[model samples]
Target: MFDNVKNNDTQVSELVASICRLASCMEGRGDAAQREETLHETLRLTYKLEEALNQRNERIAYLDRLAMTDSLTGLLNRRGFQAELQRVLASARRFKETGILAYIDLDDFKQINDTFGHACGDEVLCHIARVMERMTRGMDYVARLGGDEFAILLVRSQWQDGERCIEKIAHEINSTTLRWQEHLLSLKASFGIQTYDHNSSTTNLISAADDAMYLTKKLKRDKCTLSAAE
Candidate 1:
């Protein structure tokens, strides 16, 4: 990886060196033919320089994607999600739309790991990631915010619609099952949702949704406790 980066740097340096030599030739006192040759060289070097710069830019963009993408599930990492959230907020302000943020925490994920092992845990996360990817539109941002936690953003949506959308998503997630080896593992997640307009800040919005998710999880736990008692 470092070698590839260095090679890109070297290509850029070589193109720049060629451009500098052409500049020196144009600056020196010379005859018309010599000056014409130098001018042609400069013009050719200009295109090469532009091409080199384009390649460098492409490499930078690729690196950025690598930095922002989660390795496990191919979803956006936390940093990427926050950056995307900022963009969605800006877009909402400009277009006068509302954005929805849903924070999801997988229920009893640790126990699943303790019983079935880490490989099974990984399968569960990947399976859930696929379900989320399937459920969302291409434009929507969905990220696994590390370790049984995921976030979803719905742009240009109304509060009621966003609420309903998350309800459906939660149902889909909670009802799903992943068959790993000999066992069929039940998957469940608790979701906390918040609606944001231009007035909302990313930090506060995330915190709000996270808090809501905790509340949802607690309520679900309490309901289960009550049912067991009854």
Candidate 2:
């Protein structure tokens, strides 16, 4: 919003400068016969300038959106995610509301990239992101925190509600399959959830959720190793 306002102000300043220049030209070389032509020229220039500024503003807005979004999955990027986390935390604290923060990581995502290639890996990520969006409430926030990792914020929801939602999302993601070219790929994810605590700082909350997710991943790996040994 601030950027839009600033850009608009700049456009207005530019227009004013152009008008001043036109006024100077008219004053210095005025001819009663050509006065009408000069006024028409000024109007044409003004319209052109307005059209150019509008296009520039539209481009600026598109670039800003791209900056905030992950190009691969169309989810919020880390910068956008962090900004939203701060906002959600502030609001939760102010209203003494309960919410949940979840850190999610795709299981064996690197292996997929190595085996099938980057294109398939990207498809899987987008699939997971889309599934998450479909499973969560409209008010919830989901973001991609870099390669194969994502975060979710369940605003104004209780611990139980968040737990259930996460379980459903994780289940759906695991069950879903992606068909890339002639190959079929199954997906799975590990999730770590941290319920909102009024006293917890944003850093602590994020750390807790990340730790939980790491633990979950480790346990899964251990189980697989043990089963293979047997």
Task: Give lDDT for model 2.
Answer: 0.87
For model 2, the stretches where C-alpha displacement exceeds 4 angstroms are 1-14, 22-52
Write one digit per residue (lDDT tens) for candidate 2, span 1-230: 56765777678788778877887788777587577777777898788778867876787788788889999888899998888888888887788878999999999899999999998888888888998888888899999999999999999998998999999998888887889899888888999999985566789999999999999999999999999999
**Highest-scoring model, TM-score:** 1
lDDT of 1 by residue, 120-225 (tens): 9999999889988888888889999999999999887889988988898888988987899988988999999999997888889999999999999999999999
As a whole number from 0 to 100, the lDDT of residue 222 in candidate 2 is 98
Shift in Å, residue 11, candidate 1: 2.8
Weakest lDDT window of 10 consecutive positions for candidate 1: 1-10
RMSD after CA superposition, every candidate: 2.0, 4.4
- Tell me each candidate's TM-score: 0.90, 0.81
What local distance difference test score does each model get? Answer: 0.90, 0.87
